[model samples]
Target: MGPSRPERARREAVAKVRDQILASLLSGRYRPGEKAPSVRRMAALTGRSRRSVHEAYRQLAAEGLLEVRWGSGTFFAETHPLALAPETSAPPPALPAIPLELRRLAERLELGEAGLARLVAYWAGYARDHVELAVVECNGEQRGLMARELGETLGVRCREIDLAELGPAGARLRRVSAIVTSCCHRDEVAPFAEAAGRPLFTVSMDPGFLPPLLDALARGPLVMIVRDRAYGPVLSRFLETLRLPPEQIARLAVVEPDGLIGALAERDRPGALYVSPLVRDRVGRLDLDGWRELEPRRFVARDEVDHLWAHLAWLRARAQP
Candidate 1:
């Protein structure tokens, strides 16, 4: 027998939720291995019921477009069948002055149209060959991870440097086309970036972590694991902006990598776990079979990356004659 009208309506509702989430995944609104918004939050955001949202998540999970990590909440699958192709994707924004600049430079050098064409090709190749970015972080672990992420995303070489060592690394920094660091460290990294005359970019925390983190704090104790002690306080300060009560904030603990095992061992029940990307592999090695793990770590927002790309393109466009 076929479904009744009401039943069909319910099915359509579920499909709508599924399709919306799927579109976001395909659009890179959420990146691979990135956590999705919580079911409650998603339901509220989409004006759908929790049941519909749950069913939508289930459908995606079954298809492997999303992963349901038991206690870790849901995440976009790292590999999926629906990868977008380059040709089908929209191209990055192009600077309008590129051709004009090329023409002007060619005229200045007394190069004809054919020579201008060659000059354009040469400049394009030079930009591609020399593109390098520096990622500065307060600690070694984060520096490496951020550098790797930026390198992979932008298809450029990345030099990872610690903030503490930035002054001594001026010569190395000068060779990089730009410097990037977390927004929290902008002030700390600015002087060095200015000294080296390299453009500075800042990455913000991914919004995906907020729902899960807030839920965890409301439920029970929560511990955030970090690779460096100094980083913990910076993270705690960011959390304060969430407007959580002092008591609720107290329930949240930030622990260094070495203290994670102990923190987990002593955590209260119904609590959740959050670990930095720098220490995620190590956390995976522990006995977290039944722990409710929440997503931690930050991502370079798409706008931030796009802005950086545009800046680099403009630099290439303004090539000296």
Candidate 2:
């Protein structure tokens, strides 16, 4: 009457892979008629198996979202049904690129061409220094991705540190010029920053997190797996800002990483399973059968990054010899 466990697992793996590609498509990362990455490339990128990725691509082809060529790689459909309509109240365009902003500031300071070049070089060197900024997160994968994205956005080489490992990072922690983290993690991270005597800045959680949140609620009861007890309250506070109804809130459960496998076993039909950044690695290691591990993409918000840029500029001004 029901699908076998392995069959269900295959379906779930395919669905999760499909969602990843769909997100990239919706975000305009892959434009119409653009060549999509090959199965091998995608498997490597997502750290998923080749079979899962191939199944996902085949499913998308059936849905008219992708075109697969025998010799050539897969390509995004020229006219897909999932075309996103422009938003009427879309947010304002981001502030000019960081380099452009720096150039403008140089002009305002009345620097000549040579002086401007020197200023640019100085800032570039400082930003590219690996010890300049430390990015903290509970999950290793999320931490690395977040740090890499922020570093690219700000032209900085960030030091990635796990929240749990902060205690052991004595000299490395002290060497960094500043520390940054998701606003949702500020509480847990603040104590570390305070102890290290380092200034802390928080970037707002990316809006991309909303899609997965809504999808999880619509599915049924939801269970969130987090790394430690500290994240429970912190995540709760962040969720409050979203204004979820009390009924929907009641449908959610926050469990520690250790409890995840046991919790799943207890439920005959588990609803949407969400993993916080801290526990992502743990979830990946578990044999979830068909259960999908939904985690939001780690992205740096432009406005927050601009605020970070301002702070870095001020520090540079004060540090001038």
- TM-score to native of every candidate shown: 0.54, 0.44
lDDT of 1 at 273: 75
Residue lDDT tens for model 1, 28-106: 4667788889999999978889998998787667556688888899998876433333244323322222344445655
**Can you list the residue pairs that collide in candidate 2?**
none
Tens digits of lDDT, candidate 2, 220-279: 666777655454555555567778776666666678778866767766566777776555
The C-alpha local distance difference test score for the whole of candidate 2 amounts to 0.65
How many clashing residue pairs are found in candidate 2? Answer: 0
Say which candidate scores most in TM-score.
1
> Per-candidate RMSD vs. true structure?
24.8, 22.5
Q: Who wins the lDDT comparison? A: 1
Summed over model 1, clashes come to 0
